[model samples]
Target: MIKLTKLAVLCSLIALPTQALARDVNDLGVDVQAATSAYIVKNTNPRYPGSYNGSRLEGWALMSYVVDTQGKAKDIEVIMASDTRGSEENAEKYLTNLEFAPATKEGKTVEGGYLFSFEVGKYFNGYSNDKASRGFINEYDEINKLLQAKEFKKAELALAELYKDHTKNTSEQALFAWLKSQYYYHQQQWFGFDEQLSVAYLLRAKLPTDIQYLVAKSALQWYSFKGDFNLAYNAIYALDNIEGKEFSEENKLATIKQIDDLLARTPQINSQINVSKDKLSYLSLSRGSIKIEGASDVSKLQIRCADQVVDLEASELVNYVIDEQSRRCGLLVKSANPAEIKVKQTGYAIVNSKFDAS
Candidate 1:
């Protein structure tokens, strides 16, 4: 695997916001979603390696990056790829020479991020489309129109309804995630935007490439900020046994290093969740374990992942350690009295980090 000597993701965005930031879009009274988006000004694909000039082996690489005010690409992530031999390295090298037309907001150049996907000798045009149901499509169109009309309240109601019923298929879920994320973005509600964006990220393979880009770009910020290295990487590696799924992380070296850096810079989480009989408390972890500070005060604890849940009896003290398998997982603390729960990163996350770039 080829490695960058040093990498700082998304320019200076590594220190992710905990949703209480002042530098977010809300500081500027402008509609970010309606603002002009960035575009490539100079995109020259890297030359095929001479060693594989006539070889049958080929691959593709997809990167997620931001265009700074000066139109320079920074904080790049090798978000997806195919078996593209050494094409992943070439894609990283291409960043030095690539440029973009900076996006404009409120008549001034502003920073925005996007995707760049390329393929080599082997073109997998069979990359299939994962479509939503007709009912979902119609409702999606209506919700989009409402958002465009700036009917925020109606759009929120529609999104709530859609969320309740979008579970019929992965594609429908992805579409709903993308739409709701855009809704929060327009209002500069960063907290809601990234939280819902993380949903689209989990079902990334079901989303179109463009939607994947938007989801990934925002994910780099939200997940990294929360110190959820395991969950963040797991979301990007969400490809299942689905046939015709084009994106593969066979070349995870680049993205792994990027996430490592983001996670390293994100402040460690040593927080508490107080639970009561009347309400259940939820705690999201980036990488760490959970312990009940006063187990005697708790009645039940639900250790939750994206798809599974493990219930623990809280009659005694409880300590649950998190590892690579604990992905996109959270904890639901239940207590008859007010119980103090502590969550912190015990060690860095490592599941399949030993990837071969060759």
Candidate 2:
């Protein structure tokens, strides 16, 4: 006896031309009229079972139906459901009775199939109240409070403890990874932060939409800070593809603007060394390697350390080392042309170098 608690049908007009409409209903082709303007006309709160055995089962059920030219819903079908007991049946029944104002295309009545996703769960402001879920929620809140208070060490300790407990739930695991990433970020552990954030981003499909957006946003910032233009570009691409009724139009637009701004400032890491005459050049290194293209005219590349000087050939790719003792070193590039040589450093700060070799 599961009581349906809240039911909301988010109708998005998938604009398709009349000519593209498939004659066969089984084709899975969308035949919706392009609306000049669309709006949510109804929101229903249905009753659902609160919990089962101290744990709440939360999932989404999708129902597809066509709004006829007469403004009546017809040909209702349950496309997918997480729960088969009654959620799918109820969604189908509810959608069959739902009505909508007829959609229009070029000022003519047209039938359109719309997808309705029913969020089935214990909705306490979009949070579950299941015992296990509640435990995690409470722990997260506690950690969040500590973080807000700038108790970073305490937060880290708490997070470490939380991570020790094994949980098979995908969403919970994602949440934990996200929190760990944030903690590392606050600690200024950039490598750990980036690694953990990547894990969260990959597991985003299992997370809630809001959490997914957060993960993407955080990844964008991390990649930008690391000067990883490629990763930043990928993050923006992910943000662009994220679309749903759960996200507000304003927020989505704001995120797009944020991505644009980040892209504008991101450096193009082509991994090429451009050397000019008598000018010291600096480049950020990735994995202790610098690939210098168009260096055929160069004669010699010399790296000067406190103890020794290592000379390298003017090849397509070069590798250098920066040990703890020789962190700050000098580089001298001698080329046939008055070249400006670029050396990529694989650390936070660029090593001191002098390009005095003529």
Candidate 3:
């Protein structure tokens, strides 16, 4: 069977309009200004099975047909299908009954190909009696049961087999990783737990919206517990990007508060500094003159401001006087301990360069 990548499918869909009313086929092309100008007055979606061996299966199918001069679809064929058990057949049957406005070229009816894509998932309610889908669902249920029963060892074994069986399914892979993370947490295997949870977190986008939030929240908890503030901060950042009705209003407020609390506990960099791509850190002195102190040896320190580069030796306090007209200053510290560099503007602000430690 020929397999079409998602990119290829998208490109084909995009190119359909141009080919639908090719100038060569008809001099005036379709009477409609756009290929999609002809509208479908009546349409029906394919019916999906309620249960595929006691479990719901979801996927997509692509069908193509020609809208004849009579505004009726004919010669429907399935071009591709994620699952062919009944998706292709159902889609073809539905397309045949679909009615569209007749496409006209030069004021006369003309035939044009139409592509229809069907998504079979939660939207359709039915049961599939397919053997492979049923087998996969059963295995998933068995492992979930073991996990719920606290049979960690057995669940681990079952999960391994499940992974081996469905390596091609990204959603299933993420679910397995999440389950393994839970198993490790229950077993007090902290490192293993974090590792597995990290895998699941990175694969969160492949999961559903609700699952994405759950995985991100779990990651935030684990990172916070481990005192890895940087990773925790990142997890909070990821959570902020996820927005959906699945998350309640109260929950959203609580999440915002959690982010604020985390940020408050995080250390700040002294002096407002902007790090450039060239590896030079810049401090804007438009606010006021700032004093910098090196915690470690700073004999090779270089400071550049107003296009003037100055080499300074290690000292208890290095004062750089900035003219009111000077808006920016740059610092390049070369020391065994980069974390020792500190900057302060007396009575104004104290900024710590935690990024130097990273």
Candidate 4:
């Protein structure tokens, strides 16, 4: 969590990538002119959920919806919600009444999809460690002490008890996920650390900007150090997004440089993960191509973008080479035994690749 302190809650719901990959517009087999992006024609503000009134809980909702040729938002999906109770419901209701200007291709209306995130209470600035239940605070403190003392056995028991005993609201879930990630990191459980930290990262969407920044920064440090280039890129991507918006151009470059420096000694990377059952791994790329390969256990590859989601069987990805122009994507692999997906970044950035660990 070094150097990125000022970035507070800009991106919401899910952590963002630098620039998402969009699909090629020419899906039509016949000749079609270049398509123009859809735009918002009208909007309606979402009403506050009644459950959130005066509650210490806070959260955000991320949705993906299709705008038909008539510019109506439909096929709505609540991608993520921090407060599961009503956050998704609010987003769905809001989108049901939303309007848009349909995208066009060759002067004719065409369908398009887009993602949107809405935050509740604009982040839970009212909630803090002091506001947590005494039981949670005591358990957290005791676990911290155990972790600090390298008493892994005790820390493990305490963490388990904390989860089962505590009423985990949004804030507590994020905090507990981070503490669990620390436990994994200390035990040198790289994959566990990555997955748990990612949970912590996403769960903080409605916490606080400063908290979000620290989580993102921690992710960047850990992923780069472990040679998990795919996620490290995501961390830096989200960080750059915040910095680019909040700081001046020069300052943005400086802040990004601080991140780039973290990966300076890293070698070129091909990220992979092993799974014994169903698993999904987010894939990101900025300037190069990627070829995804794995055991036949990979049942499908799903690449989702602002406008579309594409699914491919494992057979289809064997020789696939994703170039600079391709959008960022992810793979959903299923297996009866241990199978893996290898994401090889066969490109380089003089200032891009982070740690040499991969």
TM-score of 4: 0.62
Model 1, span 1-358: residue lDDT tens:
1111111111111111221110111101112354555555664544433343332333444454456778776655554343334556655666546666676655778665443443333222364224566777888899999999999999999887876564344466567768988899889896567545654654455577666755665665565555555445544443222245455555444666777677666545665555545444555555545565555566556554322346667745577675443333445555566666665655544222321010
Q: In terms of TM-score, how similar is model 1 to the real structure? A: 0.44
Q: Estimate each model's TM-score.
A: 0.44, 0.38, 0.37, 0.62
Which parts of model 3 have CA positions greater than 4 angstroms off? 1-134, 240-244, 248-254, 266-358
| Candidate closest to the true structure, highest TM-score | 4
> How many residue pairs clash per model?
5, 16, 13, 7
lDDT of 4 by residue, 1-358 (tens): 1101111111223222211111121221111233444555555543433433445444445555566778787765444355345666766666665666776655667665454554444224454322346788799989989999999999998898987677345567677778888899899886667656766775544234665677878977776665554456556556655532353557545645655665455445566656544433334333244566764556545543323344556652553433222222233344555565676654543224232111
Error of 1 at 261 (Å): 2.1
RMSD, each candidate, Å? 20.1, 21.6, 20.4, 8.9
RMSD score of candidate 4 (Å): 8.9
TM-score-best of 1 and 3: 1
Best candidate per lDDT, number? 4
Residue 245 C-alpha lDDT in model 1: 47
Model 2 bad stretches (over 4 Å): 1-132, 243-358
Looking at model 3, report the run of 10 residues with the lowest lDDT sum: 19-28
Question: Given candidate 3, what's the lDDT at residue 31?
Answer: 25
After superposing candidate 4 on the true structure, give the runs of residues whose Cα lies further than 4 Å from its correct spot.
1-46, 50-131, 205-213, 226-252, 258-268, 275-279, 295-297, 307-309, 321-338, 347-358
